[model samples]
Each structure stands twice: as structure tokens, then as C-alpha cells.
Target: MKIISSKIVITVLLVFATVLSFAQKDFQGQAYYQTKTSLDMNFGGRQMSEEQKKQIAERMRSSLEKIFILTFNQSESFYKEEEKLEAPAQGGGNMRFRMMGAGGGEYYKNVKEGKLIQQADLYGKQFLIVDSLPKLNWDMGSESKMIGQYLCFKATAVRKVVGGTAMPFGRNNNENQVEAPTEYTVTAWYTPQIPVSQGPSDYWGLPGLILELHDNNTVILCSKIVLNPTEKEKLKVPSKGKVVTTAEYEKIAQEKEAEMRENSGGRNMGGGGRGPF
Candidate 1:
């Protein structure tokens, strides 16, 4: 009787341990975000009528607003744009609208490892930016707000703006005429209820999961959160593109943009008609 009882106890313990292991491995979360960026319509300091400004804004609406998904676990997260067909740009002009140094492709961040890997498609070439995650010193505020079902707290950080101060728009002739700000103030609203140190885009390091983030002219807000879904997202690290450090990649991008401008003779490359105003 004693031997039979020992066998039964061992079987139950093994089954419980197996179940626990699967649960730990499958624990994950998904957050959906809506992002919008504003653009300065003053092209080359050129005066334009309100009609023209309205037309320009309407044409650039698709690129200015987008939806993104962040799939994250306790120590890792992957952020990327939700897949959808983009509308064809109006008038097929030579000038193309693009977000300068914008977040493109997949961004993988491992908080535990303090590592970041981003896939960037510059011009037609691909680049994998592998570097340490940027550290932001956040000043936690007493302010609180409700984002969806979660109560969030506010935090602010000041970060130096890298690259040139170009508006998030297509290349315009008056780009050099506009003076860009050298610094940006980033504000984030995080929820300790979620208890994860992750956020959309390059914003992170908060004590909780960031639900809303504001950086300069752009805002990213969390629209939905699903914890431990039945199906899990494969949080795999991105490996495509030419491997380069963050500094090296930035230098290469700057050099290429300069080359393009020089070859185009200082003209707006995408705005083939009267110009991008």
C-alpha cells in the first residue's frame, strides 16, 4: 500500500510541473497603438494659400497616420507596423514623401540583455542597426490618467535629437531654410497594472508598460491590450540587412542623402512639378 501511494504522488507532481512549464513559456502580451505625426506646411518659406495647404495635408494623410502592434514578453518585445495595403500617392510626382529617420521594418528590443536591433530600409538598401538600448532618465510625475481600463502615470524625459532637424515630410526645396530644434521633450504615460518595461518605438525604460507616448510632433497611443492570448506571437530577433552599429548606420544614411541632394542639384527629388509646397 505504501509503494502504490508513492507512485501516485510522483505522477501527480510530474504532471503539475509540466503544466507550469508550459504556462511560463506561453505568457505574453500584445498591445495595439495608433500613431500620428504632424508636418509643417511652410515649404521653403514659400507663401501658399489655405487651399493649397489643405490639399497638401489631404494628400499626405496616409503617411502621417498609421497603426502599429507591439508584441512583448517580460524581457523582450517586437514592434512593427500592422500590415495593410497603402494607398497610391496622388499624381505620381518625382518627389516622394517619407519620414526622415522614421521607424521602419521590425524593431526588436531585449530589456534584460540591454540590446536593440532595428531593420532599416534606406533608399533601396537594407541595414540592420544593432546597438545597446538607449537609456532615458525619466522624471516620474504625480499626474495620473485612465487609458482604456488601465490607470496610467505620467513621466517625462528630455533627449537630444539626432540627425538633422527636418520636418517629417517629403524632401522640399526649403528644407535648409527652416531651423530645426536640437532637443525634444518626450512624455510617456505608463501603467503599473501591466507591469512590463516596454513601449512603442524607441521609448522604453519606464517602470510599467507605456500606453501613450509623445515626442515632439508625434504621438503614439495604445488602443488595446491583450495579455496572454491563446496564440502567441513569435518574438524572434530580426536578422535581415547589412549589419552595422547605430553610429555607422547614421553616418551612411547621412552620406547617402547628401549624395542624392548633390546629384539632384539641390532640387526637390520627389516634388517633380512646381515643388512640394
Candidate 2:
């Protein structure tokens, strides 16, 4: 009887310890992010006057800057664009160009379940792109930086960047296409205090929440963070769209994009008139 009583006491103590640990950890929060892309107008800069280039840069700036909100809890996150802006359309003129990038969809990631759902649209067609959650193999660094009073530690990872190349110098009408992935180093600064494996877009697998991320010409920084806010947060999984695997959606997207470009006679710029989802 005494041995059983001691075992019971030990079990009770263990349960109490687990409860304390869980209560102290924060798992709910909202992170506001601002993304900025540095435009390279060098392609047509020399051909145009200084004033014209400035105007183009201004337009690009307006298009490139965007705001996003990422609400997360523990191992799940939902990221969405705050503003849905219309893509610029060109009306058959001398020059045809527009800023281009990805991530115009409802992004949801569940690290615990190893699931990722992206509600995407390509040329008026809706698709639910399903794939595994992004897993970044990070090399933690001793270097540190402060982002909005939160002390963040630096980490780096080599990631494959897809769809980087643009149409070469030519009419680009009836040219072939195959998007190949290229390797690029991604730099991130995360705060360990938050203890959530999350970042902007398709980046994850850090020891903490990533505060700032840099990838080539684009940079995403966390502007604000609210931990366990008074407002109720819902990080629900999205389930409304034409479901398709990542490979399937890629094939469909490429085919649709090619068809649109051909239909527009190279006049369509900025993803061939695809709207932000």
C-alpha cells in the first residue's frame, strides 16, 4: 500500500508540473508584416529619359509595397494580404512591362500536421493548392539584432527559388517556357522568446518566430506583434476551392499563363493580368 501511495504522489506531482509549464507558455498571437521589393528598372532605364524612369519607379513602388497579417497559435498560422490591389493592364503600346511576384492567396500552414493549404487563383480560376508545410533547415548564428524591441537571433538557410527568370530580349511572343528552381540563400532573424516555428509566406522551421526575412530583391519585416490579444483569434483551416495538389496546380498555372500571354499578344504584363487573391 505504501509503494502505491508513493507512486500516486509522484504521478500527481508530474501532472502538476505539466500544467504549470503549459500555462506559462504563450501560443496565441498576431504578427503584422510589411513587405518591400526593390525594383530593378535597369532593363529599360538607359532607353528612357530620367523623368520617365522616375515615373516608372514610382509606379513600381506603388505596386511592390504590400501589407500582410499573420495570425498564429503554437504550430499553425494563417497569412493573408491585407489589401487586394488590381494588377496594372497595358493597352498595346510601345513598351509593355509590370512588376511581378507570387503569394496572392490565402496561406495556411499547420506544422504539427505537416499540411499546407493555399487558396490560389490563376486567370479567374480558383484552386486549393495542397502541399506539405515548408521545412527550412536553418543554421543558427550567434549574431543578433533588435526588431521592435524584441531581441532576435540570426539564422540562415539555403532555399530553392522558383520562377525567377523573365522573358528574354525579343518579341517574347511564341517563346517556349519551363520554370526551373534556383538556389538562393535566405537570411532570417527570429526571436526565441516567442518559440513558434513560423515566418512570412512559405518559410518555417526556425526555433522561434521570424521577425525579418531577406530574399534577393525582396525583404519582409515584422512591423508589429501582439501576444495573446484580448480579441478572439481564429486560425481556421480553409476548405473552399477546387482542390489540387501542388504539382497539379503548377501544371495548370503554367498552362493558363502561357495561354493568356499568347492571347494577349505580349501586351499583357504583370502575371498576364492575374489578380491578387
Candidate 3:
């Protein structure tokens, strides 16, 4: 035949170019993240009034910008869901009592606004795949730490919170309620010389790529890390709104702050506000 059909088409094009060069060397490259979280509020049993603790730390920094959202492929994912507010009740109150109180008297006129949701599940409640592998089985020692020069290593994981069901309003009548499930202790840090294993927010399980993280007083700090560009892409996984997990989103944010203090008809309004400052 025509020279044995040109040697079977050059051995099927050299086995499809060696499987596209081993799928481009098992593709892995993409980074850029900035995660900063710090929250501490006890108000020691309400009675705030330092302008309501600066309007409960500006409504806990606008409810932590509507419960986190930051992504980037090649490693980095922190999207603990819940973000439906395209102009519904609008970014509800407490910008330090609307710019230093006295906007309409009556201690900011029985504040009870709405729309600005995000009923808890704070720091990285889910979505973590930085460098994959390590969902729990502890003992990952190596702490050489450096962060800025990228040489970090340190890992510790333990997650468990078994019971759920809480809907502090927005759906679920009968004044929703159901609790039990609180246990956490997560500490992480990673940096396989930025070979991607992302970090910052919902901190991913590390093998190489988690700048720093914490649980039990929430503290997500990755500050900065940006690399490889062409208009970034790949890093998305958000969708668990209406609260879920993280102790049923803190029991639907304490039953929506006691149903906004009984519809604000019983205002003692001290420091029962909220924040993520």
C-alpha cells in the first residue's frame, strides 16, 4: 500500500504528542490572593454605647462584605457562600450610627433596617483546595515559616460540628430554631515556593499553599501574593447561601439577633449589634 499508509500516520502522530506532553505537565500555575480577617466581640453582655461600639464596628464591616468571596486558580479558594442582596434591603445601618449618630434622633431611630444579610459562618466555612490533600489525619510538621520570601510550612487540622438547622428569618416561619454543633481548631500555613496551593480565606488544606489561618478567635492573614497573569482565571466555588454549617451559621446569627430585638419594639439597643472588624 502507500508505504503502509505512511507508517500508520506516523504512529498516530506520536501518540498524540505524548498525550499533549503529559497534559502540559499536569497544569498547575495561578496565584493571587489577599485575605485579612479579625473579629473579637463580646460586648460583655450588651450595654455598648461608645456610639454603640462604633455602631458595632460598622455593622461588623458590612457583615464581612457579605460573607467572603475571593478566588484564583493554581490555588486559592475562600467562598463560604451566602450573598443574595442585589439591592434588596440595601446595606443596612451602623456606619457608626450613620456617620456619628444624630441623623434622626431617638438613638438612631430604633434601627432595624434590612437587606444586608450574611448570618454568620464567618472565616472560611468551606471551599478549601489550596494544594489539595489533607482533609484530616493530622501531623504535618515542618514550620520553617517566612511568608514574604515564601518558605513556609506548618499544618494542623481538626474539624467537627455535628448537628444543624437554623434559619433566623428570610425563610422558615415558626420563628426557626435548632442547635448543637460547635467544635473547631484549625491552624495552617503553607508555601511550596508558590507552586500553587492557594491560601487566604476559607483556608485550603495544605501540602503547599496557605499563607496563614486560624480558628477559635478567627484570624485569616495572607496579606498578599500575586503571580502569573494574563488577566487571571480559574478559582470559583461559591453557593451555599441561606446559611449552612459553621454551627448552622451561628444558630442563624443568634436567631437574627433575637429577631432584630423583637422587631425593635423593645429597644434597649446597647451593644447587641454585630461586626467583623
Candidate 4:
């Protein structure tokens, strides 16, 4: 009788272990990130009163601040902006600005398959950018810091800056142009405790989960993390867009912008241009 009882106990233990393994395999997490971009209000050597500058800054606030969410499992993740109602432009006839890159639409990454799929709505058309995951050569540093409750390690990478300019307010002249940076020095902070190689936007390839990222004038920081949440996100690759590679998409955008400029007789279009985001 004693031998029989011991065998029964062992069998139950094995069954529990098997169920736990399955649960671990399907683990999912959600991370909330707050993103902010700094604007350069230099005014191009033109003297402007402090009150005017403040008003201009207020006009740009809607495009500068945002919240995003990253839903992930072991190999698949989706990053997207959390939808919220933006305030109307403060001044009447003020043009509302939105940046084109990063946080455009849905961004999906499959680390195990080395694939990237992005859904972008550009020029009144939807485009799916199908490309390999960006190959970033991360230089892991010894520096460490705490973001929220996680201890994060520093990493750096160099990449070409994404170029786009915002139309200067109240001026159609070329002299007041604000040049986008030509190079991007990205600094990322990742926490090994999470053991997932995922980050906001196009940043990844770290040994752990990235909690903070600094790219040129923009900063993305993780504010909250929920491991194995109640509602699991179905990580589906986005499919609602015209198929195009990254280069093809960029060429199309440039051509469309040129055509708009030519049609408008080389004048700014309703104060519209890419904002710093």
C-alpha cells in the first residue's frame, strides 16, 4: 500500500510540471512607454519675444508628447501608439503637425524569424513595409541605472538620422529652415531580468528587455510593465497595406513630396511638414 501511494504522488507531480511548462511557453507581457521629442525653436536668428516663442511651443505640444504600448511574447512583439484625443491647435488656422517615422502605425517584429513588418498610412494610402529586422551593432557598456523597478544596462549604436523638416510658422522663406540632424547616436537601457530582446520602435538586439531609449532629440522610456497579463495580445502580422520594401517606400514618399512642391509652385503647403517625433 505504501509503494502504491508513493507512485501516485509522483505521477501527480509530473502532471503539474508538464502543465507549468506549457504555461511558461505561452507567456506574454505588456509595457507602456512615454515618448517625448524636443523641438528647436531657434527662430533662425530672427528676434522673437518670449511670449511669441511660448505660443509657438504650445502649438507644437500635441506632436511632441505621446504614449505607446509594446505587447510581446518570447519571439514576437507589436509596438503601437495608444489612441487618445489630441487637443485642437491653439491658434485658428494653425497647422497641426505629425512626424512620419516611428509611431506611424502598427510595427511588428519577429526576432526568431528575423523579420519586420510595418503598416504605414502615407499620402492617403496604406503601405506595408516588409523588411528584415534592422541589424544594429550594439556596443554594450558597463554603465547601469534603474528605470522603474528594473536595473538596466547601457548600450549604444550609431545609425544615420532620419531626415525631415517642419515648415516654419508664419514664414514661407527658405532661410528659416530647421535642418534635421544628419546622424543619430542611440543610447538604450535594457534589463536582463526580463530576458526578452525587445524594445520600442526599431531598437532591439539587446541581451534583455530595453526600458529606455534616447535617439537624437527623442526619448522613449518605459513607464510600466505587466508580465503575463490577464488579456493576452494576439500578435498578428499587419496585412492592410500595399506591399513595399523600405527603399521603395522611401522613394515613393520623396516623389510624392516633390510632386506636391512642384504643384504648389515651390511654396509650403498649409504649413505642413514632418514634425520632430
In TM-score terms, which candidate is top? 1
Tens digits of per-residue lDDT for model 1, 149-233: 7767799998776555553233454545445566678899997667668998766798678999887667788999888898887
| Per-residue lDDT of model 3, residues 121-215, tens digit only | 22233221112222455457744556665656678777654322332322333443323235466677766554344444333445556666664
Compose the digit string of candidate 2's lDDT tens values, residues 80-172: 888666667533233433333434678899888988898876655678888897677899866765687676778998865433255422246
RMSD of 2: 9.5
**True-vs-predicted CA distance for residue 203, candidate 2, Å:** 1.4
Q: Is candidate 2 or candidate 4 better by lDDT?
A: 4
Better of 3 and 4 by TM-score: 4
Q: Order of candidates by lDDT, top first?
A: 1, 4, 2, 3
Of candidate 4, the 10-residue stretch with the lowest lDDT total is 268-277
Once model 1 is optimally superposed onto the true structure by TM-score, how far is the C-alpha of residue 33 displaced, in angstroms? Answer: 0.7
Give the clashing residue pairs of candidate 4, or none.
none
What are the runs in model 1 whose C-alpha is more than 4 Å off? 1-25, 165-178, 267-277
Candidate 2 local distance difference test against the native: 0.67
Predictions in order: lDDT: 0.72, 0.67, 0.40, 0.71
Best by lDDT: 1
TM-score of each: 0.81, 0.75, 0.26, 0.78
RMSD of each: 11.3, 9.5, 19.1, 9.9
